[model samples]
Target: MLVLFLLGTSSSALAKGQKHTYWHLTSDAGEEAGKEFESQLRSVLVQAEGTHHTTEGSLAELLDQKPLKVPSCFEGAKLCTTVPELLVEALGVDGLVEGRISAAADGYQVELTLYREFGGTPKVVTRSGADLEGVVRDAVGALFTLEAAIKIYTEPAGASVFVNGNLVGESPTRVQVHEGNHGLRLEKEGYEVLREDLTVLPGEVREYNATLVPKVTQITVITWAESAAVYVDGKLSGASGAPIDVMPGAHSLELRANGYRPIEITFDIAAAQRRTIQLAMLKEVEDPWARREQAIRTYRLYVEAGYALTLQSIGFAGATADIAGSTYSPTSFGGEDRASLVFNGVKLAVGYTMERLGLVFLGVDLMVASMDSELILTAQDTARRESAVGQGASHIALYPLQGTFRELWGAFGAEAQTGLGVSFDSLNGDLTGDAFDLSQTAVFWSLAASGRYYLSEEWSLTLGYRMDYDFADQRGLRHGFFAGVGFNLPLLVDAGGESKDESLPEQLEEDVPVEGTDVPESTLQKLEQSGTEGGREP
Candidate 1:
C-alpha cells in the first residue's frame, strides 16, 4: 500500500525546537515506531540541507528576504527541526516526497512540501538512506561557502592587479573561489574598479583577462610620460596616478614613455602595500628614472661612458696682424669638435641618503679619451720658420662637477686638471729638434656647460661646449656631442629599524640618531670641531 505518514514545508530556513513550521507526523500506525522514523528522517534531512531550529516565534519573520546567518557549517551545525522552503521549492513541483526505509533494506523516501496549508503538491525522488550521512558530511567541510579558483591573465604582459582585499599577484588576473557565493573585485590605476559575485567550483579557473577601459577617477598625477598609458588585466586603466580600485592579489604594472617605444613592468601587491601610481618621464636617450633608482646607489657613480658634441672656439687679435693696410692671413682656421666621446676609467663617489633632509654627494671623475681633437699655434722671429705648433693627445684627466656645485636646469661642471699631451708639425719647419715634442706636458683649463636627456636608465646623450686654453698660448675652439651608456655597481644601505631604546627607565628620554651625523665618537667630535669653526652645519 502507498503509505502517506506526513507532509509539510516551512517559510523559514530555521525554527526553534517544536515551534518550527513543519507538517506534524501521523499515520495508520498511530504514534509508535512511526514517530521514531519521522524524527530520524527529519534530523538527517534538515542537517544536510543546512536548515535547523529557530528560537523565534514567527516563521515568516525569521525567513524574511534573507536566510538567518549561522555559525560556520564546518562546525557540524545540528539542523534537526527545520529545512528551508526554498530548497523544497527547488523541486520545481509543489511539495517534496520523502520516506525512510529500514537501513537494513535499500533506500528511504521523505515527503516534503511548501504552503501545504493551501494544499501545495509534493514531488518524489528516491535514494539510499545511508547517502544522507555522506551528504551532510561533505556539506560541512569548507568555509566561506563554495568557491572556485579564479584564473586571470593580461595582454601586452604585466598588468597591475588585486583581488578581494588581498594581493595575489602583480599581473595575475586569475584567482580561485569555491562553490556557493563570493565577492570578487579587480583594479588597476587609471581604470575603474570591477567587481561581482562569483559562484565557483573545484575544477573551474575563472578568467578575468578583459581589456580594462581607462577611467579618470579621483586622482590626478601628471609628471612625465609618453605613448604612456596604463593597463590592468588586458584593459586600459588610465594614465599614471589615475585612481582605481583593485582586488587583493598579484598584478603587473607598465609605464609607457614617448618615443617610437614604450616601457613595461611587473610587481607584487599585498595588504598594507603602497598602491600609488606615478611616472617620471625624460628624453629617450638613457634609463628611466623609475628603473635607474632601483640599482643606483650613488648618483655620480652611475655615469660610466658618454658622448657629446662640444664647441670650443676662441677669437684672438693682437697677435696675427701687421701694421699694414691689410690683415695677415697666416693659416686662418676655426672649427668645433662636432662630435667626441669620453669614458670614465677611474670614477669614485659615495653618499648617504635618507628620505628626510635632502641629499648630499661627494665624488671625483677621472676620464681619459676615447676620441678628441685640438688646435695649436706658434711664432718664429722674422724668419719664415712657421714656429712650433703642438697637437693635444692622450694622457688626460677631467673633473666633472662634484660637491656643492651650481644650480641650473642644465648640467654644469668646472674643469681644471693636469695631463701629458703631444703635438706634431708647426715648429718653424724644423722637422727635427723637439719639433715633435711641441705638444708636451701642458696645463689646460676648461669651463663647460652641457645639457643631457635620458631615454632610459641604461643609455643617455649630452651636448656640451667647452673653452680650453692649453699652455701653448695658442688657443682654439673644439666642440662635440656624445652618447652615454651607464653601468651601476650599487652599494645598498637599507636602514635597519631604528634601534630601540633598551637602556633606560621609561621616564628617561630616548636619544635620537642625528641626521647626516653618522660617525664614530671620535669622528663625531672632529666634525663638531669643524662645525664650531664654521659656526654650524646640519
Candidate 2:
C-alpha cells in the first residue's frame, strides 16, 4: 500500500528545501534482514522530505551492466567488500547507503557507509544493538540536511540579497544556509544586478562582498550644429542638446543637419566609464547661386594688391590748316600707334565689408591704379610754334572709382564691382621742334570682375578683368586683365561684437561619478579635468 503523511508546511516552502536523493545498495547481511533494514531506512528518508530509490534487480545483474570495471580479488572470489561508488553509479543516484551485519559481543552489529556520488571517502556510521532495523533508520535520518552560515554585504549597504532564488534580508546580514552549491544575487535600483554561484561547506561560516555597478552609463555628445540628429551605431538617438546612455564599445556616431554635411565619428567607452565627444559638421556646398547668397551673409576684411595690363588708345581733334581759321577734324591713329598705347600698371586696394543688407554688402573701397601711355599728334599744313596751337602729344594719367560684390564657393570665389570716380591726365610730347606738356582732369567710371581660388584658409589666387571708360570721349576706353593673390585678417569683433561660431557650446561636461561608487578617484578626477580643458579650447 502507498502511504501518505501530511507535514503542515506550505508547498512552496517545501519545494524550496534542498533536495537529496540516495540509493540503498543490497547489503552483505542475510537477504531477509538486509531487506527489512532497507525498508526502515527508506521510511526515515521519506519522513525527512528526501527522495530515495532501491534496486529490485539481482546484484550480479547490476554489476555486469555498470560501465565501471570491477577490481579483481586475489582468489577470484566475487569481492564481498562493496565499492560504494560503483553501486551509486549503477543506480544513477546522488549517493548510496550500504550496510553489513555481523556477529559482535552484542546480539548483532550494523555497519553503514554513506557514499556521496562525487569524489571523496564515504561517511561511516555504526550501530550495535539487539535490533538492526531501528539502528539503520536512526543513522539515515541524520544525513539528510547539511547546514552552514553565510554573511553577505554590498558597498551601498541596502541591496536586497537572495540565495537559491529565495530572497533573504538586505545585505550586510548573516543567514543560515543549507550546504552544497547555491545561487547568490544582489539587486538595487539604479545599479546592475550581480549574480554569482557559491559553494557552501557544512559547519562553516563564509563571507562575501560585491560592488554593484550602475545600470545606466552617462555619455555626453556635443556637436557644433543646432538641432542636428545624433545616431549611435545605426539608430537615431536624439538631437544635439542632451546627455544620453550608450553601450560601452566601439560605435559609429553620426550627426545630421539640413544644410551641413553629415559627420561620422567612431568612439569607444569602458564599462561604467564616462566621457565627452565633440563633432564638427562641415557645410555642404550647394549650387553657385546658393553659395553666393550664403557668402554675403558673412564676409571678412582684406587688402588686395595685384599687377594689371591695360590696352588703351587716345583720340584727339586737331585744327586743319587750310584757308580757314580753326576748323577741327578727328585724327586717324594707326596700328603701331595702337600698339604703343598698351601699358603695364599696378593696382592696390583696401576695403571693409559692412554687415550684409539682404543679398548685397554696403562698404567702401579706396583703390589706386596708375598707367603711362604714349600719344602722337600732328597739326596740319602750317609750321607750328610753341606760342601757337600745339602739334604733338605725350603722356596721360587716370584714376577710377568702383564698388564690389564678392561670393565664395568652398575654395573658389567670384566678384563683380562697379562705380564712378574722377581721373587726372597729363600729356607730354614734342610740338614740331620743342618739348610740350598737356594735362586734363575728367570724371570716369569703371567695371571689374574676378575669379578667385583659395590656396589656404586666408590666402587666394585671383584672375580679373577690368574696363575704365573716360566720359570726355577723347581718352577712349582702357580695358585689360590681371592675376594676383589676396589675404584676410581676423578681427577682434564683428558687426554684432562677437562671432556666432563662438557662442556655440563646446565640449559637454563629463559625467560625475555617483556617490559610493567603486570607480577609482584618480580616474574620475582625470576625466573631469579633461572635460574642462576640452570645453575651453576649440
Candidate 3:
C-alpha cells in the first residue's frame, strides 16, 4: 500500500517538474502519529498541481543525514529562529512546508507554515478539531489552495501595482493573492495614486477597475489688487488669490484690473507641483483731458513786467489859443496831435480757466511814459512846441474772453485776448515854458494778440501787439508793441475750485485735447496697437 501510494503521488509530481518539500511535521501526540501526519501531508502536496513534493527523509538523504532535526523554535506561530541564508539552496526545493501539532481539548491543534524559495513573509494557518487527519488536511488545503485572483485594470494602463506594500505586476494584469485582506496601491506618472483595502474569499476572482486621476499642478495667483481678474491659458479662471488647477505644462497667465496696467507672462509647471505667483499691478496714466482739467482748475498768480513802444494820437478839444494875434475861443480850438512815447509797465493778474468755457483775468496795470520831442499843437495854428512831457496811467484790467488756437512748435503757442477796464491817466509837463497839466479818468478797452515761448513750467517769454481806446475828454487811440517775461505761480487748490494760469495755452498744448485738432494717424494706430497687445479691456 505504501509503494502504491508513493507511486500514485509521484506520478503527478514527476509530470509537473516543480520541486516542493515537506520539511517536517511535529506533534506531541507521539513520534508515530507525527510520522503518519507528515506522510499524509506529503502525499497530498505531491498529488496537488504546480509543485513536486520531496519528503524530509529524502531531503535528509540528499544532505547525507540519518534524520533531520529541524529546530523547534522554527515551528512556532512566530519566527523565533533566524532562517539560514543558504537554507533554500541547501534544501534544493522551490518551496518548503512545515507544521506543528499540539494536544487540544477537542483532539488536536494544527499550525501550518508555507515558505517559498523566493523569500517573503511566510503564510501561516491554524486550526483545531477532534479529527486529526481532517484538521491536518484542512490546514494544508488552506495554506496551499486558498488563493484569490485579482484582475486590476487602470484607466490609463501601465501603473505599478503594489499588494500589501509589495510591488506586484503593472495593470492591467492579474495577480494571485492569498485569500485574505490586502492593501492595493496603484501609481502612475502624472496621475494620482489609487489605494484600496480589499477582502477576498477562497478561490474568488475579483475584478478591480481603478480610474487614476491625473495629478494637477496647483497654481496660486496672489495679486496686489483684489479686484484684479486672473486668466490662465486665455481662459478667465477667477479673481486674485484664487487657486487654479492645471496640467503639468507650459501655460500663459494674465491679470487685469481697471485703472491699472495689465500683466502677462508664461511659465512651465511640473507634475504634482505647487507654484505661487505674486504680482503687483501698475497704475495707468490718467487721460490727457483729466490732467488738463486738473491743471486748468488750479489757482495761479501771474506777474509780468514789460516795455512798450506806443504811437499815441491825442485829440485836443476846448483849448484856448492865440492865432496870428487873434484870440480863439476855447470851444473853437479843436485839433489833433500825435506823439511817439516809450512806456515801462508792470502787470499783476489772478485768474482761472474752465474747459470748453473760457478764462478770466482780473489785473492791475501801471505804466509810465516819457516823451521829449517837438509837437505841433495843431495844423491850423501852425505852432511848433518843444515839449518835455511825462505821462502815467493806472488801469484796472479785465479779460473775460480768451481762446488759444494752436501750438506752434512744442514750446511756442499763440492766444487772442480782448478786455475792457477803467483807467486814470495823468499828464504833467512843461510845454514851451508853459505849465501843461491835465488829469483824465476814462473807461478804456483793449484788444491783444500774443505769442508765448515757454521757458519752464512757470515762466515764458511773451511778445504781443495791443490796441487801446480811451473814452474821455481827451480821447486817445494807442497802438502798442510790448515784450515781457511772464511768471505763473500755481496755488495748491482742490479740483472743486475754478482757477487758471497764464500758462494755460502751453498746458493745453501739452495735455488738453482740443476739438478739431489733427492728430497723426500713425500715432493713434500705435496707441491702439499697444492697447490691443496688452489684451485687456479699457
Candidate 4:
C-alpha cells in the first residue's frame, strides 16, 4: 500500500489565467497488478477534473509520436523531476503525471510523480502494496483543489490593481488565484496609493473593499475686498480668485491689499473636503504725523471771534470841602459806597502757533466794551454819582499746552493758554457834574483755555474761558467765557496728507573734521539715497 500526504494544497495552483492542462501517463509491473493497476490509476487521476485532464494517448497523438517515452518528460534526470520544456511545448500542457507499478515482496510497489512544467519542483509518492488503486486515489486527492476567486472593489472605481507587482486589472475586478499570500496594490490619481498583503484559501471566495483617502484638500479663498494677495504659510500663492489644493493640516493663511489692513488666519483642512472661508479687509487708519507732532504740524493757524463779558471797578477817595461843614468818605464816592460795573464785549483774535517751540503763539486780540462806574460825593450834605465808559484792545503772546483725540476723519482737541500782553483804553468820567479824563494804558496778562471740535479737515468750533488782568493801578480783573469759530490756513502752512517720513539720520558738521575725511562710495551713496546731507565739505 502507498501512503500519500500533502503538506498543503494551494488553490492558486489554478490561478486565473494560469495554464491548467495536464497529461497523465502510466506503466505497470508485477504479475497480477499489470493491467488492473493501470486501469485503476487512470480512474483516480480523472477525479481531478478541476485541472484540464489530457490523456497520455492524446498528448502522444498531438505530438505525432508512438510509444512516447514517459521518462523523457524528466529530461533523463534521475531523482530530478520537473517536466521537460520541450515535452510541455509539444503537448501544450501545464504539467504531467507519471506513474509506475513494479513487483515487490508484498505483491507490488507503486511510484507516482506529479510535475508542474511551468516551474517549481515536482511531488512524488511511492508505496508497496497489493492495492495500487487506493494509493493513486489518495495522491490525487492531496495534490489538487479548486482555485479561490478574489473580488476587489474600491469606493471610487477604476483603480488599477497589481498582484505581486504584476498588473492584474482595474478594481471591481475578480481574479482567481491559488490560496497563499499575495502582494496587492491599488493605485489611483489624486488618492493615496494602497498596498497590502493578502492570503486566501482553497475554494474560498474572498472580497476586498477599500476606501482611499485623498492626498490633497480643496480650499477656496474668498474676500470682501478685491485685488488681495493670498498666502499659504507665508508664501504668496496667488490672488483670491480660485480654489487651492493644499495638504491636509493646520495651515496659516494671509490676505493683503493696498489701503487695507492685512489679516492672518489659521485653518485645519480635512482630506477631500471643500471649504470656503470669508476674509474681511478693513481700511487702515492714516496718521501723517505722530500724535505729538500733529499739533505743531497742522493745527497752528486759526482765526477766532467771540463775545466776552467784563467786570470793572475803580477805587477813589475824596473829602467834601467845608463849604457847609460836611465830610464824605472815599468808599462813599460812588453813591452805593462801591464803584463796580459789569460790561459786555466782543473779541476777535488771529494767531499762528509753532508747536515744536512748546506751542508758542503770537496773536492780537481786539476787545471793545462799554465801561461804566459811578462816584458819589457828599458836599454841603449833598450826595452825587460819577460814571465812566470806555473800550480797549490787547496784543497778546500765548503759550498753550494742547492735547487731541481722533474721530472719523478729524479730531477734537483742547488747549490751556497763558498770555502776557499790553492793553490800552480810554474812558470819560463825570465826577459830581465835573468832566475829567479817565484814560489808562498798561501791560496785561490772561489765563485762557479752549475746547475745539473739528467739524472738517480745516474748520472747528471753539468754546473758551479767559481771565484778563491789567497792571494799571485800581483796575479790576476782566474774566469771561467766549465761543468762536476757527479756520486752518493751508496756504500759510502745508499740512501734508498721510505719508511716511523717509529722511535719514545725519551726522552734525561739528562732529566732522574741517577737512572732510575720506568716505567709501557705498557709504556716500547710502547717505545720498537716504536724503541726508551733513558734515563739512572737503
Which candidate should be chosen as best, given lDDT against the real structure?
Answer: 3
Estimate the lDDT of model 3: 0.58
Where does model 4 exceed 4 Å of error? 1-227, 231-238, 241-245, 249-254, 260-300, 314-338, 352-360, 371-373, 376-413, 431-435, 442-445, 470-472, 490-538
Of the two candidates 3 and 4, the one with more favorable TM-score, higher being better, is 4
What would the per-residue lDDT of candidate 2 be over residues 1-538, giving only the tens digit for each residue? Answer: 1111222332223234444343434444466665666566554454444544443323344355557665553122132345647545543446655656655676556776777766478888777777655565556545655356788989878999998888989989987777678899998865789999998765346899888876666567665456789888889887876886886667887778864567677777765667676654443444444433334334566666677776655553222322224222334333232222555555566555433311112222222323233333433444332222233333333323345676556667787877775655443443334555445555667777889786654566879897878776556787888777677554334343322232223333333322221434553344344332222222
TM-score for model 4?
Answer: 0.40
- For model 4, residues 261-325, the per-residue Cα lDDT tens digits are 67787888876677776554443433432322343345456666666565555433232222224
Query: TM-score of model 2 relative to the true fold?
Result: 0.35
The lowest-lDDT stretch of 10 consecutive residues in candidate 4 is: 507-516
Per-residue error for 18 in candidate 4, Å, reads: 24
Q: RMSD per prediction, one decimal?
A: 25.5, 17.1, 20.8, 18.5
Q: Candidate 3: which stretches are off by over 4 Å? A: 1-215, 221-250, 254-263, 270-272, 277-311, 316-337, 354-358, 375-415, 429-432, 439-444, 451-463, 469-477, 481-538
After superposition, the stretches of candidate 2 with alpha carbons farther than 4 Å from their true spots are 1-299, 316-340, 354-401, 492-538
Best by TM-score: 4
